[model samples]
Structure formats: structure tokens, C-alpha cells
Target: MMIQKQYKFYAAHRNEELNDKCSNLHGHRYGVTCFFEVERTGSLTTLFADFDDSIEPHLKREYDHAMMIHVKDPLYQTLLRHMKETGETLRLKCFSCPTTVENLAHQLFTEITEMGFRLNRLEIRETDTSVVSYTREDWVNDNRYFASYQIPPSESVS
Candidate 1:
């Protein structure tokens, strides 16, 4: 037995490795579809609310309206310096790797699984026409190379 859910988030990112327009900072209305495997024995294998409880808050805090950037991105340091100097806040979700749809899928998959959900697969819709999918098997194969996402510490007032 299995269940599926769809979620949406708006975020900004750039692909530094790309030479095209994608290398420029841009935002997207991302769509995520998650599939979970459940046991067939129960009257309700899982409640839909359980999914929302686990994922919605994470999406809101980390990805929604946030700038998803790699720590090595030039803009990252500039933004951090500006935030410290001017005492402004920027919602930055830093990643050890590029903020690509594939990586996003892996990150979310790992998170959901770690939260004790039997996640079977995850799909990220980067754009209207571009989508990336990851399965449990894929995650197992690539888990060794996955780098966890990072959140920069707040600057101390001096």
C-alpha cells in the first residue's frame, strides 16, 4: 500500500556550475510530490495530516521564500557580510552542495525517512517542464556522497 501527496514552495536559487541563464539568481514555484509505502493491514495505513505535520513546517521554514544557496557561492559571503554589517535578516538555506532539484529530492527524502516515515520516492518539479525524481533505491546508492544542508549561525553583536 502507498500514499502520495503534493506540496508547493517558492524559493530562489542559482546554479553556479551552469554557464546559462540558470546561473543567475532566480525564483521558482516548486512542486513536490512524495510517495510513501505503508502496510496494508491497517484500516488507515497513515493519516494525511501526518505528512503535513512533518513536512509543511520544514518547507515553510527552509524553502519557502528563502534563498537556497551553496555555502561556496560568492553571493553567500556577500549576503552574510551585509546582514552582519547592516543588521538585516536574509532567509538563507545553505547547502554543502549545489541547490539542484536532484539534491533537493535527496535531502527531503533523507529527512522524511529520518523522521520515521517509510518514504518510497520523491519528485521535485523545478519548473513547469523540468522535474527530478528519486527512489529509495537511488537514495541508498547515493547516500554515501550526500552532504547535509547547513544553516549559518547568527552573528554576535559586538
Candidate 2:
């Protein structure tokens, strides 16, 4: 019932609210796993959404080589000034709150959901090994108990 696609992008960001070392402007190669539920009768066409044609252009254009900045952050001005002085148009995405991994995941999840995709989950990784996963079940309003399955146990787990 669930399907996923992984994507890669590079970005610069600093988390002002947390005041952690991430408070410093830096870049990272990010990995994101987008999850969707199969629609036997999909809304778009044959499938839920096209990665290359649909999601790619929208997400890649905003995130690839982009800088994430909160408007309240002092570094926001610095980055703007630098861009103005250098005459280099850097891809920048501004957030109202701190740019944390969790926040970014939620942001993407919201956008994808608005696009009419039944987003099941989202996994964000700053590195290949470091990952954070999110789902509607992760938040309070969407929480519910899953019906216990009586299927046989998997050999892999045993």
C-alpha cells in the first residue's frame, strides 16, 4: 500500500531558534525519501505522481543548491548582502521558523499533501546514514491504533 522514492539535493542552512552549531551557515548533501500510497484509480494519471516530471522540477528548483534562511535570523541579511554584492543569484528558500531537519520534512510533507498525493511518510537524511522519518501518524491529530494482524511471523525477524 506504500511506495517511496528517494531523492538527493544540496542545501545551505542554519537553525536560528535552536542556537546549535547548525546556527552557522553550512551546506550538506541531503537525501529525502518520499512515501506515497498506491491509488488503484490515481488522481493524476497511471500512478500517484511522476518523480521526474512532477515532483522533480518543483522540489529540485527550490532546494538544489539553495540556502534556507529564517527572516528573523541576522545571517539572513548577511546572505542577502553577499548575494547582492556578488551579483550571483543563489537559490534561496526562506522559512518563517528555524530550518531544522524535522521542519524541512514537515514542510515538504505539507506541500506534497497539498498537491493531492496521499503522502504516507517522509524520511530526510543529512547524510546517507543519518535519517529522520515522519508520517501523519507521527503527529497528534492523525494518531490512531493499527488493527493487529494475525499473519505468520516473518522468518527474517525470527
Candidate 3:
């Protein structure tokens, strides 16, 4: 059997590698839907994963109203400068990885796997019309051999 859940989060980010206006900061009401593969448990309940227990809380914490800033982004330092100059509280949650939709999919995949849910597919939608999907099989076939999210030793924070 297969069970699915859809989750949402509001976040802001920018992509510096791009040549267009995306170089400016922007926000999105991102949507993520995960498909889970499951088997009947024990005496025979069809339920495999609970949305509230397995997913929602984590999404709410990691992304809701958060800022996704790549570590190499200069804005990262700019934000720090502003904080130091103004003594203001910067409540934004900074992500260690780039904030593109593809990276978001990878981030969510890592989280879902760590939570022990058996996932079949993950769909990350940047907008109502723009979306990207990744299957578990795709991750297995990736050249990085599923270690795509690892921080290289030279880049690791001290």
C-alpha cells in the first residue's frame, strides 16, 4: 500500500549563481508532498504513516517563516553585519545548503529518511505551476551515491 502527505512552509531565499533578477531575495509558500511505501502492520492496519506524527511538526519547525541562505552567500555576512551594527535580533533560520527547489527536495528527503518513513517519491513545488519530483530510485542512482548532502571536509564548519 502507499500513503501520502502534503506539507507546506513559507521561506525566503536567493540564488546567486543565476544571472537574472533571482539575484534578489524572494519568498515562497512552498509545498512538499511525499509518497510513502508501506505494508500492513502487525494484526493488519492499513495505516502506514501518520502525517501529524511523522511529518508536520518537523516541517513547521525547519521552514515556517524561515530564511534559507547558502553558507557561501555574501548576504549571510551582510546579515551578520546588520546585526552587529544595530544589535537587532535576526530570527531567520539559516540553512547550510543552497535554497533552490532541487536542494529543498534533497533536504526534505534527508529529513524524511531520518524519521524512518519509507518514502517512494518527493515532490517539491516552488509555485503552483513549478515543481520538481524525485524518486527514491533516483537517489540510489545519483553519482554521489546518496551522499549528495554531505558537506565536504574542506567546507565543514569548525
Candidate 4:
């Protein structure tokens, strides 16, 4: 079964060296939709996991009204370290990493997966007509393939 949920956050960011209008700091009211594919564990009374219970809180804290900074930005790097040292809540869009839709989806996918939930797909909308999606399959197959291996049963090997 597949379950989907939508979230919104307001954030600001810029490509520091893009040399375009986008290089000037700006904000957007962004929307993100996540689709989760669930495999049945043969449990009763559930078609899929609860979106509220599984996904909402993480979205709120990590993305909502937060600055999306680039990890390589020296200023952002310094501020992030200061925040860590002082335990201060960071300003929205004040991130230590780039805040592009691709990066956002990548980061969110990792976060959700690490939280013990399988993320099937992620859709990030920067505007009503502009959208980007990242699928779990894409992540697993992103030029990092290793040789496949399998173990045969002991009896079959004998």
C-alpha cells in the first residue's frame, strides 16, 4: 500500500555565486509531498502507516521556516557551529548546506530512512508549476553500485 502526505514550510536562501536574481537572498513558501510504500506485516486495522504519527514532526522541525544553508558556505559553517555550541535554535533558511529542492529531498529522504521508515518517493514544489522528485530507487542506484553477491545454502554447496 502507498500513503502520501503534504507539508509546507517558508524558507529563504540563495545561490551565493549564481550571479542572477536568485543569488540575492529570497524566500519561498514551499510545499513537499512524500509518498511512502508500505509492506504488510500481516497486521490488522491498518492499510498503511499513519502519516501524522510517522512523518509530521520531522518535517516541521527540519524544514519549516528554517534557513537552508549550503555546507560549503563558510559563513553558514561558522554560524552552524556556534548554534551547536550554544544550543540555539537556528534561523529559518539559515542552513549549513545548500537549500535547493534536490538537496532538500536528498536530506529529507535520508532523515526519514534513518528514522526507521522506508521512503518510497519525495516531491518538492518550489512553486505551483515547478517541482522535483526523488525516488528511493534512484538513491540506491546513483552510480555507487557494488558487485552483487549471494550465499548458497550449505546443502546445495556440498
lDDT of 2: 0.70
Q: Is candidate 1 or candidate 4 better by lDDT?
A: 1
Worst 10 residues of 2 by lDDT: 149-158
> In model 3, where do residues sit more than 4 Å from their true spots?
42-49, 141-158
**In candidate 2, what are the lDDT values of residues 1-158, reduced to their tens digit?**
67778778888888876656877789889888888886556654345346546677766777888887766688877777887899877677876556778767767776677677778888999876789889877632322211133222111000
lDDT of each: 0.83, 0.70, 0.74, 0.65
* Candidate 3 lDDT by residue in tens digits, 56-155: 8777766777677777788988887888899885545555656678777776786788788888999988988999998886655642743576753112
What residue runs in model 1 are displaced by over 4 Å at the alpha carbon? 147-158
Total clashing pairs in model 3: 0
Rank by TM-score, descending?
1, 3, 2, 4
Give residue 119's error in model 1 in angstroms: 0.7
Model 2, residue 84: displacement in angstroms? 4.3
Leading candidate by TM-score: 1
Specify the poorest-scoring 10-residue window by lDDT in model 4.
149-158
Q: How close to the true structure is residue 40 of candidate 4, measured as C-alpha lDDT?
A: 67
Clashes of 1: 0
Best by lDDT, which number? 1
Off by over 4 Å in 4: 41-49, 74-89, 92-97, 141-158
Clashing pairs in 3: none
TM-score of each: 0.89, 0.76, 0.82, 0.71
